[model samples]
Each structure stands twice: as structure tokens, then as C-alpha cells.
Target: MTSFLEKWSARKSDKPKAGMRSAVDAFRVRVAEQKAYLAEFESDGAGFNKWRSTWFQRAPGGFGVTIGRDSIDAGQGLSYVVVETTAQVAEFLDDLAQHADNDVSFQKALEQNRLRRAALLNSAKAKVKAPAAKAATRKPATVKATETSQVSGEASVEKPKRGRKPKA
Candidate 1:
């Protein structure tokens, strides 16, 4: 029979990953025109901040975020990304650029941004070693006996009592 401890361990392992981090080069995209994610990052996916546009709720309140990593310091084409939590990723893909629909755009932007990151990661998997799934183990089943013979020469069994209506 499967032990409680084994079941507990399996459940624990099934919990969402906690150490994922992602990184990716930053790029600019118009929120109104962006069809994919501006960035992507799952704290425990492949690597932290790996995708130029993505979101991760590192802080409290589980507020999702879109990410933008840029080398704006050197101005060598200014590498950076913009992030929005919730479904507002696409709206905020590039902060510097102007978009009138900040509120809605922000929400949509966040979602699109996440999707973009996911696509990139999928592509990366095709090129690299996609992580392997953890294997789960099950214990052997136990046999269930239905009948027994008594030492006194009688079938030592009692029939279950019935006909009790539950009170409302």
C-alpha cells in the first residue's frame, strides 16, 4: 500500500517550482502593435530575468510584473524592457514609447509580454535541453480480505445494521 509519507512527498514535489529564474535581451516594441510578449520571466522556469519581457511576483501581494532588462547605461542602442503585472503586459512593453491607452494597454501588455517570453523559451527548448519532468513513485497495492473462518466452527461475521434514517 502507498504510505502517507510517500503521498505527502509527492504532493510537496508537485507544488509550483520556487527557484526558477530567466534572462533575455531587452528589446522595444510598440504596445499597440505588439502581437507577442515584450518580455518573459518565471522565477523558477529556466533562468531569472532571461526573457527581455516578462513578469514575476517577487514581492508581496502576488502582484505580477512585466520585465525589461536594458543596457541603457551605455546607450549602446539602449537595451531594456518594460513589465506589467496581471494581464497588462503588452500595454507596457516599452515605457519610453507613447501609448494613449495606459490603463487597458498596461493590462494587455502584461499578458502579451508573458506570452512573448513563453514563445521565446519554447524556441530555446528546441535549441537546448528542455528540463526533464520529475519522476513520481507509487507503492505496491495491498490485498483486501473479505471473509474469515472462526476457530469455534462458525463463520465469525456480523451483518451490518441498517434502516436508520438520518435526522435532518
Candidate 2:
């Protein structure tokens, strides 16, 4: 007969609980469904933006995926899954379709997702580092004062007029 402690230890060695496994499986299924929808949209030559908007939500200037809590950090206390951008989804699909083995496909998807995220972060950083447009410089106009009429052969003092002359 097996002891209770031994049985508990055996269960603990399993790493992922049944609930966690189910959550991950559900996430995979959702990804597949999204991929199928995207394929249909592509075959019909429809605009991706419209389909994307319908499927995903915008998050911090990019798109996001909503997965179960177990799928993110191995059944952590986080309320929601980490957001995945549109590019990350595309890369994952590309990897999933290209690879034959499940493990290989998952590895490829992770690598591609990381690369896409790095590229996006770098682009954002570059935009932040870029200098702002310089404003155009204008030279001040020069005004010459001329004596219109001489008063008793003495130079008449004239004040420089500002702004446009009034219409007659």
C-alpha cells in the first residue's frame, strides 16, 4: 500500500496541474481558431484591419490576446494574461504552420515572438530618440526713412510709422 505522503509527492512531481494543462490546451485551441479565421479572411481578399479589430483589442498602441490565467504564468495570481501584439500572433501562426513537431513549433513561436517584440521596442525607442523638426527662420525686414517734404530748409523730424497705412 502506498503512503499518503508518497502519493502527494508523486502528484507534486507532475509540475503542471490538470487545471493548468486544460487552460494551456484551451489557449492553443483559441490560437488555432484565430488562425483559421485569418486564413478565411485572406482567401476572401478582405481587409485585415477590419478582421483584426473584430478579433483583437488594442493595447498600448498594439493589439492584445486574452488567454486564461493558467496559460500565462503557470497558474499564478495574475488576473489577466500578458498582452500579445498582432505581430506576435502572426509570427506564432507562421511558426505553428511551418513546424512538424509540437515542441518545435512552440519553440519557434516563442523565438519569433521575442524577435517581433524586440523589433517593436527598438522602433519605438528610435522614434523617441529622433530629433524634432526645426522651425523655419525669418529675417527681419529693413525700413528706410525718407524725407517727403522739407520744412523751411530744416530737416523735419519724422517718426517711423508702425503697421500698414490706413486706407483712404
Candidate 3:
């Protein structure tokens, strides 16, 4: 007797149902549109540049969540999303969207991520500036006794006494 899997496969149509096919097509189109929208920012232009810089000023990695095509892989599933952000932030957002039970939790996670990123950036900036600060505050080296010498009326040098001198 044929296995249940084999019977099911035999009964299934090779082609998707008409409604399903249309839905898939629509999804594909939407994904394409989303990708196009994102690509617009990648180019150099005044409007896009301004938006990229300012859009997520309050968020980490310059990202905010919306319901849209997958930012990493546009042709796949849909969920809460982030765009124009670093890969790490995108992954964090994706995980947050998946596991968060409600809006409150999601907002909390987003805020935490933003604060964490700001701290990291501030730390990095501090590290970069620390060496410069140290250099600026450094004092000039003092002249050593050996470096001084008398060479006429213009300059004088005090030579250290050689050998042991009798105590007088």
C-alpha cells in the first residue's frame, strides 16, 4: 500500500491555486517596491541624504520598525522591520519583533537598544579623543646635566668631577 505521504503527493496539484498564485505575485511586487525604496537612499542626493541622517536620530543604528518586506532578504516573509541600519541592529530588531508579546515590550526593547548604541558610540569617541588629550596635556622634557656644556661667553657647561676626589 502507498504511504500517506505518497498518496498526498499524488493528489496535490503541481500548480498553486489561482488565489495563492495571485497572492504570491502581489507579495513579490511589494518586495520589489520596498527594495526600490531602500535603494533610493543608497544614491547621493540632497533629499535622501537628509532623510538618512535624520530619520532615526533617537534610535540605535539609525533604525525604526515598520511592517514591510524583509530588509535583509526582500523576497521572503513579512514582520516588524528596520531599514538603513547596521546588520547587528537589524538582527536585534528582528529578534525583538519576533519575541515581543506586545507593543510595550517592543518599545522597551527599542529604547534599550538605542541607549546601548549611544553608549557604545560615546565610548568609542572617548577612546579616540583620549590620546589627543594626553598629548595636549604632556609637559616638555627637562634638560639633563650631561646635555649642558660651556662653549664661550654665549653658553656654559658644568662638567661632572671625574673619579673620586679627596674630601677636603
Candidate 4:
């Protein structure tokens, strides 16, 4: 069976599929627009000074925001994505842009992002010798029977319990 790290590495090695880049870029543009909208009112004193457009708290006690045309409390049609506050917009956009409605695609996108930084370091030694070294260093799996006999150097036999014998 594959080890946990092996499985994770395999998943991380997958490149983001077509359109992934565009989707991420589009999401960024939308976020920028929302920020600009809030910025437009930043200098206004017409009862806008107390507004917390990017805060995540509920209204009255706090100011929540609706996305585009969405209601503050509910998600609307495809054009709008409602959120408790504007601060949550990026997270919602991440899921939306990655098409994370399904868990698998979401995981793939997530893995792709997780390893993005590692992809850039391209050191010469790692590129030339790492694979060969890794192959040479890997040890063969040990047999379960051999493992069981390691302490006593005996054949594979179940050892009796070591504590005081139970009453007959």
C-alpha cells in the first residue's frame, strides 16, 4: 500500500487543468472591483463613516455586506454570492473560482496551490541528482514475520503473556 506522503506527493504533482488560471484571475478582478466599490465611499461622510464594508460581523452589532446584487443574508443566483461580510468574499471566490462545488476538484485546486511555491525553487542539484539519490536510498520493506522475531532472534511464534499468570 502507498504511504501517506506518497499519496500526498502524487496529488501535489498534478498540474492545474485548463481554465484554472483564468478562473483564478477572474476571481481576483472581482475582488478588486469590490474593494474599489468600498473605497469609493471611504472619504464620504454621508452616514458612511461608520460602515464596516469588509468586517465579518453581523449587522446592527456589526456591518455585513452583500455581494454585488445578493442579499446580505442569502446567496442569490449565479451572478451574486452573498456573504456575512466583505471580508469573506475572497474565500467564497476561491471556492467559486476553483469550481469547488465538488470535493474532488476542490482538492485538486487546493493541492495545486499548496505546492505552487515549491515549484519555483528549481535548484540545480535537486534537478540533477535527487531522483537518483532517492532511488538508491530507499530500503526494501521488511516482512511482518521477521519484524515479530526481531527482539528474540527466534522463529515467528506468538509469545506468551509476560505478566503474572491469571488465577486458574
State which candidate has the highest TM-score: 3
Give lDDT per model, in order: 0.40, 0.48, 0.47, 0.48
How does model 2 score by TM-score? 0.26
Ranking by TM-score: 3, 2, 4, 1
Worst 10 residues of 4 by lDDT: 68-77
RMSD of 2: 18.2
Q: What is the lDDT of residue 66 in candidate 3?
A: 47
Candidate 1: misplaced stretches above 4 Å? 1-67, 70-102, 130-168
Query: For model 4, how does the per-residue alpha-carbon lDDT over 38-96 read when each residue is reduced to its tens digit?
Result: 55444463545434443222356334444332222112233443465444654554554
Put down candidate 1 lDDT per residue, 35-113, tens digits, no spaces: 2332334234355443333433444543344333321221223233333353444344434333222434434544566
Candidate 3 C-alpha lDDT tens digits along 10-74? 67877766644332334344444444444564454345643432222225545664433222222
* Position 76, candidate 1: lDDT: 29
Q: Which pairs in model 4 have colliding backbones?
A: none
TM-score of candidate 1 against the unseen true structure: 0.22
Total residue pair clashes for candidate 3? 4
Candidate 4 vs. true structure, TM-score: 0.25
Off by over 4 Å in 4: 1-21, 45-58, 66-168
Per-candidate Cα RMSD to the true structure, in Å, reads: 21.9, 18.2, 21.5, 18.9
Select the stronger candidate by lDDT from 2 and 3: 2
Clashes of 1: 46
